[model samples]
Target: MSKKKLWQSISIVVATLILSFSAQSEEIYTQNFDDFDDGEIELGDGSIIAGTAASIQGGRLQLTIDGQGLGFSSFSIPPLEGSSQGFKITFDYEMFDSVGANDPADGFSINYGGAAMGELGSAEEGMNGKGVQDNLSFEVDTWRNGDAEQGVNISGYGDGRDLNQLAFTNGIILDDGQRVEGTMEISWYPGKGASFTTTGLNTNADFVDVETGAFTASDDHTFIISARVGGANQDLFIDNLVIETGAGGDSDEDGLPDFWETANDLDPEDATGDNGAEGDPDNDGITNFDEYENRTNPQNEDTDGDGLADGVENGTGDYDGPEATGTDPLVADSDGDTLLDGVENPTLPWDEDNPEKQPGTDPNQFDTDGDGIGDGSEIASGTDPTTEDEADENSYRQNFDGFADGTTDLQDGTVIAGAAAEVVEGRLQLTKDGQGLGFSSFSVPAIPGSSNGFRITFDYELYDGPGANNPADGFSINYGDAQLGELGQAEEGMAGGQAIENISFEVDTWQNFDAEQGVNISGMAGGADLQQLAFNNGPILNDGEKVEGSIEIQWQPDVGASFTTTGMNTNADFT
Candidate 1:
C-alpha cells in the first residue's frame, strides 16, 4: 500500500487507545509514527518517490532525494500547555549522500511548528526558511549556508559535504559547529528559558553551554510546540520524541483545541496553516486553501505551469467556463505534449512566427505535426511544429549553417564556460590561444536508446595554444545525466572539471605526461588511466586542422552505455 494511504485505516478511537496505552505524561508528549492509519501521516510533496513509498519502512523516517521529495511531513505532537519550563528535541540524522558531491552540497532540517517548508515544484535547499519565530531548529547542515531571512550565517570553505556540522537557530543563533553521528540531542533547560534580553539574535537566546552543549528555552509565554521534517538527502530517523509543557495536558494560551497540535503535528505557537487558515507560500495570487483543494502548491506560483496563473486557470476574472476547467492549472501540459497547457487549448495556439518560435501544433495531439513523432519530441528536438518531412533540416538536430537547432543547440543548450566559441562562416571555430584556454559543451536532446540506439554528429576545428609544441589545454566531450550549463565548475565555467558521473572523450592537441595529441576516453576528469580512441604521436590538431567526427553511444535498460567513434580527423580524405 502507498505510505500516505497506509494511515487511512486507523480510526481516531484506535489512535486515542494507542496514546492511552503509551507512557502518558502530564508534561511530555511524544509520537513514533508506527501503528497509525494512512491519514495519520502526510507527504504529498513526493516523499514517497525519494526512497521508499513506505515512510515508516526500516522503522525510521527516511528523507532520501534532493530532487523529487523535499517537503515537510508532519505527525501529531501533543499540545504543550502554556507553562513551558523546558523543551528539547532530539533525532537521528545522517547525510546519506550529497548531490554530485558538489560544493554547497544539500542538507536537511528538523523544524517545529514554523513555516510550510519544501519547494512546490522542486527540491528545497537545506535548512532555509523552514522554521518559524517561536520554533527552534536543529539544522544538521552538510553545506555551507546562511539565511538572511532567518539572520543566520554559517558560510565556510570546502565542497561542504563530508563535514557534519550542526547549528541552533530559534530564527537566529550563534552557529556553534557541532558534529554529530549517533543519537544527537538539543535540549532547552528552564533557567533562562522564560524570557530573553532580546528576541532575534542568539544573545537573546537563553544561554547555551557550548562546553556542556546544553540549551535554555524562552520563558516569554506558554507556547505550543509542533514538529516536522523538511528534507533532501539528509536522511533522518525519529524514535523517542519528548516535549514537556507548563501546566495542563493541552495548549491553554494558544486558544487551540487540545488534540489539534498533537493530531496534526502542528505547533500551537504557529496560528498559521496549522489552524487550517495559514499563509500562502508561493505567492500565486490565491489562498493556501484554494491551492490545497486545487492540488497545487501554495509555495509555488506556477504549479501546473500552464503559462496562465493558477488563479486564472481556476476560472477567475473573465473566465466563465466549468469550475477549474478551460486549461488545467496543475498540469503544465494536459495532453502530454512538452508544450505548456496554456498553448493551443480552448484557445488558439501560440504564434509560430520565428525560427526559434514554439510550435503551434494542436494541444490535443502528441504529435502536432503528424510526423509520427510526438509534439513534445518534436519540440524537444527543435523541429518546426507544422512539418512532417523527416528529411527536413528542422527534423535534424544540427545543420552547421551557423546554427545548431533543436533542444541541443550549442548556444541555447550550453553556456560558454572557460572558453570562447566563434562561428565563422559555416564552421564552429574553437580556440585555446596564448595563455588562455576555452571550453564549452553541446547538449543533444536525449533519444530512444537501448533499442533503436542513438547517433550524434558534430564537426569541430581546434586551434593550437601559443605554447612550444604544447597547447594550453585540450577539448573534451563528456556525457551523462548532469545539468546542461557547464562541464564541471560549481560557480564558473563548465561541469566537466568535476567527476560529474559521465564518461569523457578528450581530444587533446597538447603534449604532456597526461595529455597528448590523441583521442582518449576516461571516466575520471583529468585522471591518470585512459583508454585511447584515436591517438597521434605528435600534436595533430596544432596544424590548424579541421577534424570531423561522431561518437555513437548505445544503451540498454539494465546494461549501460558503450560507444564507438568514426571519421576522426576526416581520415576518409585525411588531408
Candidate 2:
C-alpha cells in the first residue's frame, strides 16, 4: 500500500451525547447549585430532610460540617420507569481539608440507590451515614483502607482519592469518563437496565474515570448525598448536582423494527437510509433487497461492477443464466479471461461441483483448450470449448479420415502396430485373421503429461464372429512406455517393446465349452487373473458388435497404474 497514492475519505463521529431513543416520558430536570437561592438551603428534591449537622455553608451543600460529626443528607427524586431513559445523574464537588495522608477518617458519598433515606437517615445510622452498602454509589475516600481502589497510597491505573470510582452492586458502564471533570453519566434503558461512569480531576491533573459497565435494574430507589467525619478536622461539600431523563425508544421511524434493517449500511435512525427495497443502486437490474437476500452487493449493480450488471453476468434470482456465473460484480473476469467471467461461468443446476465446472471455461484463460479459440466463441459455437481434441489441425473432428485406408497411423498421432494393424472404414483395425493370442496396440503421442493420470477414449466393434454360436478371437488393449515396439507378439500373450513397463486390458472371447467371454486387466507383473479379482461382470459384448467408451488410468509413484472403464454397450452402460 503506497501512502502517497492514497485517496480516501475517513471520519469518526464520537457520541458525546447519549443516543436518543423513543421514550414514554419527555421529562428532564437539572440543578446548578443556583436552586439554593430558591429559599432555605436544600439539596436534591428535598424528600429526605437534611441533617442538622449537614447544612449549606459558604454556598455548597455541606454533607459534613467542619468535620465535627457524622452527617448524611439526601434529595428525593421522581422515580424513573425501567422503560424510560431511566435516568442520568451528573454533579460537581470539591474535596477540601488536610488530615491523615493515607487513612483520613472523613469521607462522603453521592448515591442513587434502592436503600431508603428514612432508615439510613437516623443520626445513629442515617444522617451520619458515610455510605449505604449493597447498592450502587460514588465513593470519595480521602483515606487508605489497604484494598481501597482510590486509596492515596494506591498508585496504578487511575487509582486515588482525587477521583471517584463508581462502585456497583447491580450494573455496569460501557464507556467511562476521563479526567478533569467530576462529570459522571448514568443511563438505564428499559429492558437492558443501567450503567454508570464516574470521572473527576485534581490539582495535579491526575484523576480516575471508571465505567460501571451495565446490568439489569430491579426494584425502586431514591437519591442521597452523605458525608461522615470521625473527627473535627476535615470538611466535605457538594455542589452542582443534577439528574434528568427522557424516553428510550426506537431510532428510525421506518415502520420496521431494528432487526429488519439487516441490509448493508441501512441506518436504523434515518428513513432515508433505505433507497427503497426495489431500487437498484448498482443499477445491476437486481433490486437491492433481492441482492441483499442473495448476498450480492446492492450498492454495486455489478457487485464486481466491471462494466457488467451483476444480473447480466450473475443470472436472475436463483437462476444463474448462461452468463450468470459467480463472477465478481466488481471484476469483469475474475479468472482474467478476455471472454468475461459471466461467459465462462453460467447459472446452472445446483451441484456440489458446480464451481469446479463453472463458466464452461477457465475463468482466467481466454482459450481453455489452448486451441487458439476464444471460450465465449467456442461456448456459443455449440462445440466443446474445453476438449483440445474436439477438432483436429484442420478444425475437423479427427475420425481417421486421413489414415489412407491401409496405414497404421492416426492424424492425432496414434501409432498402430500388429500384422493386422490397418485402417478400415476410418477405424484403425488391429487384428490378425489366423489368430492365436493375437493383439495390437495404439500409442498416441500427447503429453498426457502425467504418469499420474491419463485417459483414452475410442469406439470399436468386437468381431464376435458371423455365427451366433461361432467362437470369436479376442484382443487386448495395452499401455506402457511409448517406445514399446510392436504392440503384439506371436503366442506369448500381448507383448513387445524391450525393457517395457506395461499394463493391459484383455478382452477374452475364445468362448469354447464353458470358457465364457471375460474382461480382465493388470500390470505386466505376469498377467491378471479373473478369479483373483474381487468381482468381474464384464466383457459385456457379444461377438461382432460396436461400442464406445473411455479408459482412465492413474499412477502412483510406487504403486504403478490402476484403471477403470466407462463405456456404452448394447446391453447397458458400464461405469
Candidate 3:
C-alpha cells in the first residue's frame, strides 16, 4: 500500500479507538415496561412480573403495587466491580392503595451480591434474598411489621435472607393498577466506600450502607424487583428501568463527596465554605476558630479586650491617667469622667460636641430661655435669665405708694406718693399704695422730636362725693408748667368714676396755666418740667372721701430734666 494511504488508515483507526474508549467510559442502560418489552424470566414482554408494575412519566420511573399477601420481582445483570466506584441509581414509585391491607409493605431493593430484588408484602413478610457472597442491599420499606431476624429464608425464593422490614410507611397506589410516580436517587463514592440515597417518594427516611458506605448494585446477579398483593385480586404496574455506571458521583465537585459533606455540615462544592478552618468567618479580620477559641472578640483588636475596639481607641489619643496612651493596654476613658473604658474624652477639642461632656460645662449647650443670648452670657451680664430686657424704661413709669412705710392705711396723713417707677408697654404697674395715694416716676431718656412728649395713664375710682362736680378733684398731667404735667387732667369729684386714661402732648415751657393771653406758650422748648399730679381741693371733712388710682407717667428725658409725682397708688394687677 502507498505510504499516504497507510498513514490515513492508521489515523482513522486511532480516532475510532479514542471515540470508542470515550463512549465506553460512560455507560447507561434503560428499560421501559411497555408490553412490547420483556418482563418474564429475563425481563421479557407479555409476562406477569412477580413484583409491581413500574412505569415512566415525566423523566422518572414509578413502581406501584398492593401489599396484600406477598409480591416479588427479580432482574439479572453482568458482573460489576470497578464500575461500582462512582455509580448512581434513580427511580420513582408510590403506593396509593393500602386500605384494608397490612400496612402497605411496598419497597424496592438494590442487592450487590449477585442479584437485585424489589418486594411488596404484608408488614410481617418481605422478599427472600437471592445471594450468599459479600453482598450489600439497600431496601426502602414502608412498614416495620416483619420479624427482625436475619439470614432466614422462605420457600420459592433465593438466598441471603434477612427479615429486615421496609422503612417507608406512606405511599400512593392507584385503584386502576396504573403507575404512581416518585424519584429515587442514589450516589456512591468508590474511594470512600460511602453511599447516599435520596428519594422524593418517601422524603422522611434516608438509608446508608453500614459496612461499606459505597452504594450496592446488582452485578451478574439476579436483580429481582418485586411486590406483594395484600388481596388476591390486587394488581401492580412498573416502568422506566434505568441502570448506569461510571458517573462522576460527586454532586458538588467540592473534593468531598456529597454524602460526607452533608453529614459533616460542610459545603462540598465551596472550597471557602469551611470558614472555621483558614478563612475569616466574621470578616472582621479574624478567623472563626480563633474567635471561638479566644475569649476576645475575633472581630476586634483591643489588647485589653475592652468593649471599644483597638482601632477606635488608638485613633482617639485620649488615654486616661496611668493607662499608657496606646501601649499600657488598659482601656480606660481618657477623661476622669466615669464612662466606659476606651471611650474618647470629649473634654478634648476633638469631641467638643460629644454628648458625654460634663453637665453644665457650657450653659449655652442647652438654653432653657428663648432669649437669643445663652444663659451663660445672660448670667455674666447680670441680667435676668428668665425675663427679656425691656426696650425702653422711660417710655412708661410706675408709682409706688406707702411702699417704704410700714402702715397699710391709704388714708394716713404722712402717707406720701412718689414718682412713677417700673413700666412696660407704655404703662406703669406698681405694688404699693400710700395714705392718699402713692407714685413712682421714671424720666424719659432722650428722643429726637419736640412733639414726642409723654403719656400718663392711671386707674382711678371716686368714692362718697358729689357725682362729677365736687370741689375735690382727681388726676392730671402737667407739661412745661411744673404745675401742669405733660398730659391728662383731673376730674371734678365723682364717685365710682374709675378707668384707665392716657394723654399725649408736646412740652413747651411757655405753655403755663398763668401765661399771658397773647404770648406764644407753645414755642418754649428748653428743658421744661413734666409732672403727673394727683390732688384734692375739697374741705377736710371728719371723714374725707378718697380716690384710688394707679398712674403711669411716660416722658422722654432728652434734656436735663427730671420727673416727680404724688397722690398715686400701685397694684399688682394693672388690668
Q: Each prediction's TM-score against the native?
A: 0.33, 0.31, 0.30
Per-residue lDDT for 196-287 in model 3, tens only?
35444423335443224112333343334444343432333444555555534345553334544444344546546452334443344444
Q: What stretches of model 3 exceed 4 Å from their correct place?
A: 1-26, 34-70, 80-82, 98-102, 116-131, 144-180, 191-203, 208-223, 230-236, 247-575
Q: Is candidate 1 or candidate 2 better by TM-score?
A: 1
- Best TM-score among the predictions, by candidate number: 1
Decoy 2 TM-score against native: 0.31
Writing each residue's lDDT as its tens digit, candidate 1 over 57-134 gives 444554443333344433324344332334455444332333443222233333333233222111122223222233
Better of 1 and 3 by TM-score: 1
Q: How many residue pairs clash in each candidate?
A: 34, 39, 87
Q: Is candidate 2 or candidate 3 better by TM-score?
A: 2
Strongest candidate by lDDT: 2
